[model samples]
Target: MGRARCWRHRSPRRWKQFHEGCVPCQAVGVASHDGYKRGDDTVMVDGGVGDSDESGLRSIDLATLSGVLRVCDVELLLLDGNGPRAAFASRVHEEALFCSISCGFHCRGRFMLPPDWAMLGYLHATDETLSWCHGVPLTPGMALTVMPEGISEFTLSPGTHMTLMLVPVARVQRKLTELSLRSTPPAGQALSLFNLASETTPLAQHYQQLHVQLGQGASLQPEETEKLLHEHVQALLGAGAADRPGCSRARRTHYLIAQRAENFMRLNLRRNIYMNEICDAAGVSERGLRYAFEDLFGTSPNRYLSMLRLCAACRSLSMADSSRRSVKAIALSCGLWDLSRFADNYRKVFGELPRDTLMRAPAQIGQPA
Candidate 1:
C-alpha cells in the first residue's frame, strides 16, 4: 500500500513552496494478476482532494489510483507506486509526458516514443516497453515530452516505482516558443538533433542560452513576457475558443458604438452627466446613441449609464481605499439614487452580496483580449 497526502495551497507564497518540492505522476495499475486488461469503467483511488482549498492535505492509506482525467484535454496527475497500471487512453490530438524526476524502479532501459510526443523513463531499468497508436519517433530522456502533433506511450519493468509529470502539448509549446522565435520547430524536432550519447545539440544549446539571457534568476522581461502572452492568446484563438457565435453585423456595430459610449461614460462617471450630455460626449444623436447601444449591448443608454454607475460603485466598494466610502455614498456619486436597485443589480451580475464580494474579488478586473 502507498501512503498519500493531498493538499491545496491557495496563497501564492504557499503554492510556490509546495510546488518546489512536489513530484507529479500518472499510472494505470493492473487490475488482474496477468497485468493486461482495463481495470473498470470507473477506477477508484484513495487520496484525492475536494474542490475547496480549506480541506488541506489529509494523510490516508491509498490502495487504488484516481484523480482527474480528461478524455480530450490535458491533465496533470501525481502517481506513486501503489496505483493501478493499465493501458490508459489519452485524449485525441493531446500530447502527454511522464517525467521520471525521481525513483529508480520505474526506469526503463530503452523504448521508442511516438512522433507528436515523448515520455520520460529512467535509463537503467529493463523489461518494459511503451507505445502509441499514432506514428511518432520516441526519444529517451529524463525530460520526455509529447508534441501537440505527436503521440505519448511507454512501458516499465515490474516493481517499478517512479514519479511522473505529464506535460501537455500546449504547455510545452508555450514554454518553448515564449523564449524562442515565433517559427521555432517543435520540441521533438529540436530534441531529435541531439546526439543522445553526448546530450548536446545546437538547438538545446541555443534554447539554454536564450533561457539564461531572458533571466536566470528572475522572470522574463516585460516585453518578452507580453510577447508570450500574445502568442498564447493567438493559440487560444486558433483553437476556436475565443469566437462568440450569433454576433450579427448590426450587433457588432452596436457593440463598437457602446464601447465608445462606455469610454465616455467612465470619463464622466463621477460627475452629474445628462442623457443629452452623454449623447454629446459620444458625438452621436440621442436616438442614434440609443439605437446603437441597444443593438450592440442589448441595453438602453439610460440603463447602460445606470449599470456603469453601479459598476463604479462596486469598484469603490472593492477598493483598498474604500474604508472611508459608504456604498450609499458611492451610489449617489455615480448618479444612482436607489440603493435597492444598486444592490439588486450588483448581486445579479456578481453572484454575491455586495459587501461580501467587495474585498474578496480581484481589485483589478477587466475584459480579456
Candidate 2:
C-alpha cells in the first residue's frame, strides 16, 4: 500500500553511487525520556520496560522506542532457560517522511517474532542468528529482507544491538519496481542481493553513517531524512539474492533438544545450573548440549545462562520496594552475589547501573521517602 502523501523528488541515482546519511540543519526535536516530536505524525521516545511479569519477564514497550510500533504486534522474545531475565531499550524516531530505529536487549534463549511490517533492516551487531521462512539467515550489516517472507526467528546473544534504516513506502515501492521483485505492486516481498558481505560494503558504510546521524539527534527536514532512506533502498535493489540452504531435519532435532535444555535452565535460574546438569536434564551428551545451544541460540551454554540471570535481576531491581529491599538483597535472591560483578553485568545488559533502577522507584514502594 502507498504511504501518506508527501513532497516528491526526482528519482535519485541508482545503486552504483554512494550517498552519506541524512543531514538535519534545522532542529525539530529534543532528546528526553518523554520523547521528541518533529510533527503530528512523528514521535520519538527513549524508554524501557515498565514492569516485570511473574516469571521476571519484562516486556519492552516499543512505543517508547517509536510511536509507529504497536506493543501488541511486537512479540516478547522468550528467554527459555532457568536464568536471568532482561529488559529492552528503544530509541524511536518516526516521522512523516522516514523512520530511524534502534533497540537492544539481552535474551538467552530461542524466541519467535511475528511476521509484521515490511521494512529493510540491518543487524548492526549481534552475537546471535536471525532467520526467516525456512531458516534463510539474514546477513549482518546493511541488508534488506521482505521481513515477513520466512518464519522469522532470532536468538539474541547477551547485549545484542540492532538498528534499522528506513525509507518511505512510496520510494520503497519505486525501488522494488526497478528490480522487478515479483511481490506484486503495493505489498512487496522481502528481497536481497546474494553473496553480499555485511562488512566492507557500501551498504555497511552507509548504514554506519546513518547511525551516527541519528545519534546526533539534530533537527531535520523531511527531505533530508527521505533521501537517506531512498539511497539505501536503491543500493539494496541493485544487489541480487545469493544462494541459501534450507534448514535440515537434523538441525531441527538439535533445536528441539536445545529447547528442552532451555526449560531445564529456566528452572535453575536461582541456582548455579551447571552444563552437566543441563546435559542430564535435556537427555543430551555434554558435547551435544554445546552444539545444540550454539546452533539454535547462538551462544555457549554459560553465556546464555548468564544473560537470563542478569535480566531477572534487572526486573527485581526495577520492581523492588525500596523500604523493604536493597540492591544487594535483590542480587542475592537472583543468585548473583559478588556485588561488583553483579553491578558490572547489570550495567552491560540493561545500559544502566543497578542503583539507578533501584533509585528510580517511587519512594513509598520499596524505600521510605
Candidate 3:
C-alpha cells in the first residue's frame, strides 16, 4: 500500500457541502464490492486501501486510531493475534457527529474526552459476554451508555460493532431547556449506563433507530441529524431522572483495582514491572490484585502485562521509521531485554516477527490507513 493521506476539512462551507451531497453514502456504495460483513450485521467497506478522496470508510491501524470522538491518548492493546484491523465511518452534522466503528480483533483501550463534549454509545453488535465498559459486562438490549468525560475504558471483542454520537454539552443543555427538563450534571461526571430492555421510551426508541440507521451506512440529512441529536439528549436526561441502579459494588471495586494497576503499568511500560509494585499501587493485596485482573481481563496480572508490552512494541514497530530504527531498539525500548525470548513470544501473539512488521510501510499517523 502507498502512504496514506489525512482528510482535512479546509473550510466549514466546503465540509458542509461535502457531507450534504451524500458523499459518504456514495463512498460506501462504491466500495461495496470490497465490503466485509461484521458480526453486527453491518458491512464494512475497505475504503482506505488506496488514495481515494471520496471513500468514506477508512481502515484503522492501532498506531493511527485515535479516540472515537476526538484526539486523545488512546492506547489499544490487542488481546489476540487478530493483528489490528478496524474500519471507521463518520459524519458531521449541525448538532452532532455520528460515528460507526467495526473492529476485527479483541482489544482493550482507554481514552479521555474533552469537557465540552459528551458521548452516547450503542453497542450495535457483539457477543454478550465479550464487550465491557468500565468493567461492566454489556448486554445487547442494555443499549446506551453516557460516557464520562475524564477517561473511559472499554474492551471490545472480535467483530464487535458500535455506533456513537458525540454532541456538545451546550447542545444537550439547550435541548433539556427547551424540553423544560432539569439541567444535567457536567460532562465530566461518572458514566451512566441505561438499560432499554424493561422500558423503551419514545425518545429511546428513536435513538435506537437512528443508531441502527447509522450503523447500516445510511446517511441522514442535516435536519434529521439535528432531530436525532435532540431526541438522544432528551432520552439521556430522562434516563438520568429514573431511579436506575449502578453496577454492583463488587464489580465496581474490581474495576477500581484493575484501573489503578493498569494506570501504573502504562506509566512504567518502558521498564521492568513487579507484581508487588502493582499491588502496592493498587492498594490491594497480591491475591486481590490477581482476582481483579482475572475478573476484568480474564488473565493473570503477569500475563496481561506481558501482552501489554508486546502490543506496545507492535504499535511502535508499525509506526516507526524502519530506516532509522531497528527491531532490537524497539524491543529494548518496551523493556524486553531478552531478544530471543521476546521474538518467540511476539510471534506467538502477533503471528509475525517483529522485524517483519518494521519492514512494512507504516501507515500515516492520525489518518486512515
Report the C-alpha lDDT of model 3 over 84-109, residue by residue, as the tens digit.
56666555555566766767677887
Off by over 4 Å in 1: 1-252, 320-323, 338-369
Q: Rank all candidate structures by their lDDT, best first, as comma-separated numbers.
A: 3, 2, 1
Q: Return the top candidate by lDDT.
A: 3
What C-alpha lDDT values do all the predictions have? Answer: 0.35, 0.48, 0.63
TM-score of each: 0.33, 0.50, 0.73
Name model 3 segments beyond 4 Å from true: 1-60, 67-70, 85-88, 143-148, 180-190, 198-216, 240-245, 359-369
> Candidate 2 residues 205-225, lDDT tens each?
655655555545544444544
Best by TM-score: 3
Candidate 1: C-alpha RMSD to true structure equals: 21.0
Q: Model 2, residue 320: what's the lDDT?
A: 65
**What is the lDDT for 226 in model 2?**
56
Runs of candidate 2 with Cα error greater than 4 angstroms are 1-34, 40-119, 123-162, 165-208, 219-257, 267-277, 280-283, 291-303, 319-356, 362-369
